[model samples]
Target: MIQLGTRWLVGDEPPSRLPQPVIDAIYEVEGELAEQGVDASEWSWTLTWLEGKPVVELDDETTVEYDPETDSAIVTAPEG
Candidate 1:
């Protein structure tokens, strides 16, 4: 079984497998972080599967939620 709370460093790979959409979501976050003057490899990602959907949360609390309806990844910025 996949662990409910898997943590991986920003530059490291998750030991547990992740869905393609989740990976795409991370990439989206990468670009956003870059624009914010943050290195993509300076933080970490935590994987959480909710209702069969993967939700990857970044160290700064940014999220990449998978939307099955659109078959796409949605990146949410961390709330101040």
Candidate 2:
């Protein structure tokens, strides 16, 4: 299980075998982060869920929620 903020994100399967839609979401988020100058080497990444939706959470409190139906990722930041 991975913890993000006050929520715990868990999965019952291996990451490598994640569904293609999920993989696509991960790639999309990674691309967005890269464009924003966030280096993959500089932060850790994990596949988890937020509000029942798959998301890629970054170490800096950045989250990219993936919507499989729309094949899109919604990026969010920590709220102060």
Candidate 3:
């Protein structure tokens, strides 16, 4: 079970309990960073649980909020 404010450690895989779409979205962001010549190897994924939903944040300030109703992650680009 996921506890509130659970954080995914750096260099580790994301929590399996999260939805598949969320997982894919996370990977996509990581890939994007890599393509942009950013070395995100040491960055971690931060998970903030709101009620039963998950709001994932990256070191680069990108956010991925899960929407169960749509079965997709509402990805917000990193704030500049």
Candidate 4:
């Protein structure tokens, strides 16, 4: 059983405070992924702001290896 959540980076500190609209969008996407038979534990989420717009990447079959010290994460999709 895999259960995970998304993490975001704002300007200085990581974006912990997601806007209401963004939160709703994320939840909607999460539900769609779950319905597609995505395992919760296999989730690796990345939320970033580019050009002052938010972008979200999610995958249940993909694994994101992250290092907290370096603030780096690698996203890889396993072969099905």
Candidate 4 C-alpha lDDT tens digits along 1-80: 33234463221222445444555545555565568875565445676554434455554444334433554444445576
How far in Å is the alpha carbon of 50 misplaced in model 1?
1.0
What are the Cα lDDT values of the candidates? 0.76, 0.58, 0.84, 0.48
Residue pairs clashing, model 3: none
- Rank list by lDDT: 3, 1, 2, 4
Would you estimate the TM-scores of all the predictions? 0.73, 0.46, 0.86, 0.46
TM-score winner between candidates 1 and 3: 3
Identify the leading candidate in terms of lDDT: 3
lDDT of 3 by residue, 4-70 (tens): 6767744578898899999999888887887898887778899988887988998878899999898
- Score candidate 3 by lDDT: 0.84
Prediction-by-prediction clash tally: 0, 0, 0, 3
| lDDT by residue for model 1 (6-79), tens | 87877576544666777866766677667888866767888888887788888888888878888888888878
Candidate 2: tens digits of C-alpha lDDT, residues 1-80: 54333222222222654456655555665667668876555456566655666666766677667676776656676787
Any runs in candidate 4 off by more than 4 Å, and if so which? 1-16, 60-80
Best first by TM-score, ranked: 3, 1, 2, 4
lDDT at 12, model 3? 72
Return the TM-score for candidate 3, rounded to 2 decimals: 0.86
Query: By summed lDDT, which 10 consecutive residues of candidate 3 come out lowest?
Result: 2-11
Off by over 4 Å in 3: 9-11
